[model samples]
Target: MAKGWTFQSLIDEQMAVTAHCQTAPCHHRQVLDLVKLRDRFGPDAPAMEWDFKSKLKCSRCGGNKVGLIYTPDTSPTGYGKAKGG
Candidate 1:
């Protein structure tokens, strides 16, 4: 499902992604865009092609152990159901 997602891919596209904390009893998740990393995590945030997975953290758990899951652009992207019939 992740489709071998990597940092390079993120930098190259505006991917809808969810960052999940891997800490026990604290699976916090944050939905974000690839372009917002610098604004959210700061300009110095680590975005290495290989170490990308280790950069994300949960504000609730403060854990660096994170999981990056890919998400499809929905609603306006026409990938999700309309608001109403």
Candidate 2:
């Protein structure tokens, strides 16, 4: 919707999101509410300062290299939409 959604913006919006493992040969990912990120690192911690890669650990292989992504609207269950449509 905007020019480009920054990792900071996503965190600020508290949108449901996913983090993918960036480690080679390990394509692990997880979707969770952005609030968790804020909660874990504190609201003042912007995306740049949060160092999300450092904060997250891949449950499958314990990889630290991670990338944040916006969760796509592919849910079959109609709750209208998340945050706002």
Candidate 3:
């Protein structure tokens, strides 16, 4: 886990967070809403903390073995490339 990565940090970086199910036979992934998370958990909530994982359950398999990933937005107007190469 990256140090000092709070929910606000992700928002500031315009990064998207996803929850991945690590349970065997259930590899489900879902993009999380940062605004909603920040609202629910507060902006200071630790983004990579284990306590956050305890609050999440895989919607597909109802499993607790979940992991988080932070990815920069890759839309044309977002963080990745420009309108054209």
Candidate 4:
């Protein structure tokens, strides 16, 4: 597992976090609010650490097998590249 990436890091980089349910028959996914998560877990909490998975639960299926996905926000106000260069 990589280290040094934290909730603050995600927020600073405008990364969108998503929670995905890995349990059988569920496979639910939801975009996470980085501010709320930073508040709950503190700004320094490990963002890419697998051990943090134990702290997550699926709201839809009520399962503990949760995984996190990090995506760079690509909206007009985000860090996406200009089109048709």
- Which candidate ranks first by TM-score, i.e. highest? 3
Locate the minimum summed-lDDT window of 10 residues in model 3: 76-85
Off by over 4 Å in 1: 1-14, 38-50, 76-85
Model 2 ranges with Cα > 4 A deviation: 1-14, 48-50, 71-85
Residue pairs with backbone overlap in model 3: none
lDDT of 4 by residue, 1-85 (tens): 3446788998998888889999989999988888988899899888774847788899998999898887787677566758552
TM-score of each candidate structure, all chains considered together: 0.56, 0.52, 0.79, 0.78
Best by the lDDT measure:
3
lDDT of 1 at 25: 93
Per-residue lDDT tens digits for candidate 2, residues 1-85, read 4234444466545455777888889888788555665576666665542454577788888877777766543555666755653
Q: lDDT values of the candidates? A: 0.64, 0.63, 0.84, 0.83
Q: Write the per-residue lDDT of candidate 1 for residues 7-81, one digit (tens) a residue.
A: 446555545677788898999888766666656665555554345775556789788888877655444755765
Q: Comparing candidate 1 with candidate 4, which one achieves the higher TM-score?
A: 4
Clashing pairs in 4: none
Please give the lDDT score at residue 5 for candidate 1. Answer: 47
Candidate 4: residue 39 Cα off by (Å) = 1.0
Q: How would the candidate models be sorted by TM-score, starting from the highest?
A: 3, 4, 1, 2
Deviation of model 1 at 41, angstroms: 10
Instruction: Order the candidates by lDDT, highest first.
Output: 3, 4, 1, 2
